[model samples]
Target: MTNNKNQNLLLRSEHVWKVFGDGNEKKTILKDMSMSVHEGEFVAILGPSGSGKSTFLRVLSGLIPPTEGHVYMHEKELQGINNEVSIVFQNFALYPWLTVRKNVALGLLHSTISEEEKEKRITDAIHAIGLKGFDDAFPREISGGMKQRVGFARALVVQPTILMMDEPFSALDVLTAENLRHELLTLWLEKKIPTKTIIMVTHNIDEAVSMADKVCILSSNPGEIRVELEGLPVETRMQKGSDHTELVDSIYQIMTNPKKNPQTILHDGNHIPITLEESPYQVLPQIGISKLKAYIKKLMLQGGKESIRELNTNISLDDLLPLIEMMDILGLGGVEENRLFLTELGDAYAHGNTEEEKQILKKQLIANVSLIQFIMQQLEDGKHTIHTSDVLKHLHAYFPHQDAIIQLKTALTMGIYAGLFSYNRQTGRISLIEN
Candidate 1:
């Protein structure tokens, strides 16, 4: 890790706000977000999906302009595309027809450099990323990890002062991701690249802890930088059961705490009051119904509650946190302190037969889930059917495009399973099932 003390500011954001849409339908993605990165620092931006991580990155990289405020690179206001910054995408954005050498050389196409110099830089980048012999290989001929290396090579060929990674290794298998992470660290430590700072956007908690010199946690529903932890030693991250684990757990708590203060916003240069009702909606767990049932049953068998750490011993935190949050959303359970406890509804569902479980879920869907209730209300408002586009528009106000689709699909699935509504896949319409 780089020494933070005496480092100069490399980049900064001043009260930046990114708002999509306009007028009444406008949705703010980033609000009054101010943060800075120092030279030689590896900063990880951690947030849940749909938290505008990628949007923030694009704003910082000058690919998109913020609706309000400013982003500065090296103390100068950034306008339009930033040539000093390069991004590695989640998907290896490599062309199928381009070989490794040609792909990497593409970065130099717009440069004033000579062809010979471009070839040298391309060769050096390809070799530096461990793709020397595979320079002639097409993207389809390479493994996922190797393809990502080509991404790194392409980005490096630009000789960027800042490297922006948007979940660069997320598409790889676990082992491959780990290996690439270590390789990246080795490159950073060895000063093999010209990158003065690295800013990564990731949803994986462990990956952030392991690689970041500083971790900035973003809160969703108008993503804001809620927490920033710095000076985390890389050595501590390598050890299991270390203080780093506790730090990771603390981040999880910060993200999951229901009563945590809502993020404040600036409206027309005045601090706008945020009502509790306007607070970010709780994210529904992405797990299936069976997984939710099994986990609730396990909690019940374990005296109706268990410490998250204990539960994690059997199931990974990646899998456990969502289920716990789902239980909380469904009024089935919640986390207090470090423990997870099942509510009366959760306990009943655990012991109930399949039919009874469905009944309980249906009741919860109608009572707890706002989307389902909205659909039900729409049906009651003289309309038996609602277009999926209408629901999607409603959801897009809260979530990103992809996440809005996921949330809508998930809600529709649950509603269908619970017999609350029937969706016509062919017509893209949803209708309430008559009682």
Candidate 2:
């Protein structure tokens, strides 16, 4: 890690607030958030989905104005799109009809430079991004990794002072993403690119810890900066059992602290309360049922209970927390005294056959998941079918609009897998199965 304590302040946000919609439908995405980035620094904004991580990045790059507060670039107020800032989007944003060289050259279209200078810069940018001979290749002709390289080259050709990336490597395969991450780090360390600062938005905890000099964690549903971790070196993060691991653990603690929010319990028709811990929109399980069953078996093998910290030593908090929460939601497990323990249902599922496991899952989903119960009740009432829009409207009361859509889709998937309901994608409607 480079000592950037004496470096100049490149960008800062003060009491920033971003609100979507209007009147009664309005939702606050970011709230009173303030943070700063320095020159020669690599910063990461880390949070779960719907945490406004990308929205904050857009605000920082001046792609969108905040509903309140202010953003400063080089100590001056940023009013609109900052000419010195550029962004690389997750989808690569490449023109399929244009060749790599043409796409990169587009970055210089508004420049006052001569054609010869533009050609030189374009060639240099392409080469810098490791796309040398493929300059004439179209986006469709190259691999996903190469297309993302074109994205980097396009952003680099403009010679922006700050580069903002919205999960830039998320679209690639694991190996490809890893290669790109290393290549980016090499460029930043070698000073091959003219950009002075890099700000990235990501949900991957390991990615943030491995890449960024500083990490800012955001909480969801009116996102706010929950914590800022600094001075984390790549070397330190890679070293297991180091202080870096402790820092990562601390982050998980902050994110999962039950004290931060109220715990809402869903009730079945029998009026039995089922704990639905974690975020409001996290009604969907992040891991597949098979993986969850395997985790339960592992827990049982290890005496059916383990401290959260001990469990984290093997599995990442990202994977572990969601699985634990899902288990609790299904009445398969619970957390007590900071230890996770499997219940009778969880142990049975862990040892059961595939069909039996599915049965258990079906019963749990119908009983604990409100959306599933609502769909079933609607079907029983002779509705026959429920439009996805209606489900989204109901979910909107609990989650943000986008999150509501995601939760509904996830519920549909789980419901279909459990033989509870069938979703017609073409018609955007869900109907109960003849169980």
Candidate 3:
């Protein structure tokens, strides 16, 4: 962590903690997290949904303060918004009424610099981000790729010491995203932009591996630094070699196995075991029963067990991880040594008829899932039906604010599928079907 560039200590988190809301609904988003960035580095914060990757990035840039800890920039504790950092948002945050040049100029709106200096910086930024001819183009007049270029231009026009991006390419088309990444890397690696450091937050493991000098992964249920590793070489990250493939495969294992203290991959050629905290109140994956059945059948087709990485060839990591974790929770199946397999109950359910499948799921849900049990108790305590909002209040205490509603939807998906609860979609009521 030495800074050999003879520059300032760019950024660091000191036992950072972030909590949202208060009372029972208050959820701790980060816990005792400590990390640092040096000058001349592109660091990526990598994690799943609700892992506080975006929140951590905001704290690092001094957009928000940690509830209980500290964020430091240039070796001094930061109190408010750090003027040295610029954020390239996930959504292109251009003013709809403004032309590209006008939007880029907004970056310097409050500066005391002369209009002459402002115009030069604006022109330079637009040209550097490949938006020279599009200065007069309004946001609606440009394509998604061009709009993001305008975003980069706006951030660059500030000429800040640190540039932070939050999933900058996630909103673009595949080819356009690829082109933008190449352009952005040129700006960073070739020093085309005046920024001394870059910090980005992303959920894509390959994106982190390919773009960053350092990649720090955060684990969920009160996000903490799970592991930090130096990124792979550019040639190795071209996604054409065995090294790239193997490293990506290893990362997939580490991410999907979060409930355990997963012994993860190599760091700078040395193997390390990062003991991560377990997520006890793990949120349900936003998926349906049909996908679960199909995956179970797929597992059986593979002779009851297969490498999860191989099984995930056509599926996204976001979808696959939740599905596997759901199976593990239900006693239907689990992962062992990086392989996914059906438990005895799962095998029986896989072979069972439709009625038998529901019965097995009912038994598992009743025994293992507390959320389902809570719903049944609620119905028994007062009435046969409960408003979804009432249960959502309980859910919000455990999950992120944005994901609380999703947790309810997913809970009901499994609950209704197992015949434990009946949901009224129009009325937003959940009734106990069995108790």
Candidate achieving the largest TM-score: 3
Off by over 4 Å in 1: 1-5, 239-241, 261-295, 301-323, 329-331, 336-339, 353-435
lDDT digits (tens) for residues 1-435 of candidate 1: 444323799899999999998664567799888989998889999988878999999999999999999999889999898999889999989989998888888778799988888888999998888897998999999999999999999999999989999999899999999999998887886688878889999987778988888888887666888767763576565455567777676666666653454231111222222333353444566777778888899899999999886787797655675787688878999887668898988889899988898899999988888877877888778578899999888877677676678778888888898888899989998987897
Residue pairs of candidate 2 with colliding backbone atoms: none
Reference-based TM-score of each model: 0.75, 0.68, 0.81
Ranking by TM-score: 3, 1, 2
Residue 340, candidate 2: alpha-carbon lDDT? 86
The Cα local distance difference test for each model comes to: 0.82, 0.80, 0.82
Tens digits of per-residue lDDT, candidate 2, 1-435, equal 343333799899999999999854678899888898999888989887778998999898888999999999999999899999889999999999999999998899899999999999999999888999998899999999999999999999999999899999989998999889988877876788878999999987767876788878776666788767673665564445566665565556545552332112111132212222354434565667667877898999998998777887797766786787788888998876557888999888887887888799899998898777777888778777888888788788887676677677767777888888888889998887885
Model 1's alpha-carbon lDDT is 0.82
lDDT by residue for model 3 (325-372), tens: 889889988877678889999999888999999999999887887777
For lDDT, candidate 2 versus 3, the one ahead is: 3
Segments in model 3 whose C-alpha atoms lie over 4 Å from true places: 1-8, 264-274, 277-291, 298-315, 336-339, 343-345, 362-435
Error of 2 at 267 (Å): 38
Let me know the TM-score candidate 2 reaches against the reference structure: 0.68
* Model 1 vs truth, CA RMSD: 6.2
Worst 10 residues of 3 by lDDT: 1-10
Q: Which stretches of candidate 2 lie over 4 Å from their true place?
A: 1-5, 234-244, 258-340, 343-435
> Model 1, residue 49: what's the lDDT?
80
